[model samples]
Target: MVEVADTAVRAGLSGPRHPADPARRREARAGYGLMSPALLLMVAVLALPLAALIVLSFWTQSGFTLDRTFTLANYWRLIAPSDREVEWMGLTFRLAYPVPAILIIKSLVMSLTATVAVILLAYPMAYFLAFRVHRNKAAWIILLTVPFWTSYLLRVFSWKVVLGYNGAINSGLMSLGIIDAPLEFLLYNPAAVTITLAHSWVSFIVLPIYVSLEKIDRSMLEAASDLGDSKWKRFRRITLPLSMPGTISAALLVFIPTVGDYVTPELVGGPGGTMIGSLVQQLFTKQNNAPLGAAVSLVMMLIIGAMVLIFLTLIGYWRMRARRAA
Candidate 1:
């Protein structure tokens, strides 16, 4: 009876005593309460519009009235290839290729080209600033962002001024007797579009890369040097690996938006340089086909998402290999 009483007393005293349970529960409740406003705002702002976009993609637009009838015609128009042609200003043009594929391909090519150009130019500049500029780094950073303070439209237009006939390059060349007349091919071309995009987004690449390189451990480089590694070798092995995060960031920042850039192409792309974005805009504004536009936009988004996934996967593989090799 004494042993049983002692066991009972011990079990009663040690019965799953959870300290601060009430306090933890209250803290969790407060955190959730604090997050509720932002969550509600996101649902109202982002989620609703996205849902509406998806719904709109299913409905057909006849004249100005959106038909409640659902159809897959819009998406079919994008993927199903056929002999499509257009006539404008009494000029008939026949396309042997699919219309949607051409527009999407042009956007991908232009975006990839511009992203490469921006990173190539930005990496060197970032390296210089991070390694060489011991003083006035703040001033340099401020100056780097100065171009962005101006409007994006203005920046694109500025490129127009530089590339247009009788503009800076042509005028200078003519003045030096290198050419008799202004070069007409400088503007309204894919190269011009690519160059303009590169200049426009270079600051993005430079700033991120500089930040990444700055965070790299100098000790690693010193140890490499101590081991008789050449400057190029040290940079190739250590610095490049470390700076990849910034490089990838810069690439994504430059690539994604450039794919859908309508304004730049509309202003300077001419007929040959028109992108998928231009087509989507035309569908919405000129063609009065909101449903088709929504479908196209969704398709573009899906393609871009896929491209991004592939790129990130490749980058991850490369990083893993580099780490293992090191």
Candidate 2:
């Protein structure tokens, strides 16, 4: 009789028509219904435009006439080998169309340089904010963000003024008898673009790193100290790993958007520093090749996506190795 009662109870609990199932189903339905609007908005805002871009990439445009018929000529032109060869870092690439290839390489180098600079510069400030500052921390954060409140254009222009031949640096140096002529190399080059981008994005990168560092548990550090670990060792073994999520977030935040940034490159890049974004703009407007422009944009997006995926994969592998060692 006891066995029979147990079997019956088990069946009731696992049955298809369980008593609480209806309420659970209703709750799930309500949750999905609540999320439907946001999902729709994302689809409308992001997905639709991306789909259009992809479709346009496959079409061909010529002389104010757009052909909806699918063709791969534009992409082929980008990918096919040409007679000219360029060597870099022990590798040679035969670029069919050198403009896109050169611009893409230039943009990547500039973006990476800027990202590294931002991380290096922001980390110390963020570390100070997280661990050093005790009182009026909010005021410090506000001060850090004050430069960002101005128009981004204004900020870039400010850098141009500081870096330009007749700008502040040259004038100050000239006044102080540090130099006779204005420095021509200070502006209108890759370095100038890199500097402008780094300064422009540093404040935005700091908060994420600061948040990550701030979220670290102090007890862990205390315990490490009690265990005879030096400050450097404790940070390497504890704080750094814990803060990586924010650092990685900060890196991605700067790297991805800056790769496509046309404004900084336009203002400071000049002819030598022209990025792929400027090329895309020219293709779409002056060159009147919308299809080719779309193809280049898609390729840039793909390259960014691939790089991000690889970065995440490496981070995951490192985390796994760390866990295993622990």
Q: Name every residue pair that clashes in candidate 1.
A: none
What is the C-alpha local distance difference test score of each model?
A: 0.85, 0.90
Once model 2 is optimally superposed onto the true structure by TM-score, how far is the C-alpha of residue 143 displaced, in angstroms? 1.4
For model 1 the TM-score comes to 0.85
Over 4 Å off, model 2: 1-21, 86-92
TM-score against truth, every candidate: 0.85, 0.89
Give the poorly placed runs of model 1, Cα more than 4 Å off: 1-41, 83-97, 321-326
Expressed as tens digits, the lDDT of each residue in 76-113 for candidate 2 is: 97888978898753557798777787788889989999
Clashes of 2: 0
lDDT of 1 by residue, 1-326 (tens): 22344687985565435435787667657867998999899999999988898999999997989897888988887666445665533544454435666678778999899999999999999999999999999999999999989999999998888998868899989999999999999999888888888999998679988998999989999999999989999999889988887788778888999999998998777887788999989989999999988998888889998998788878778778967997
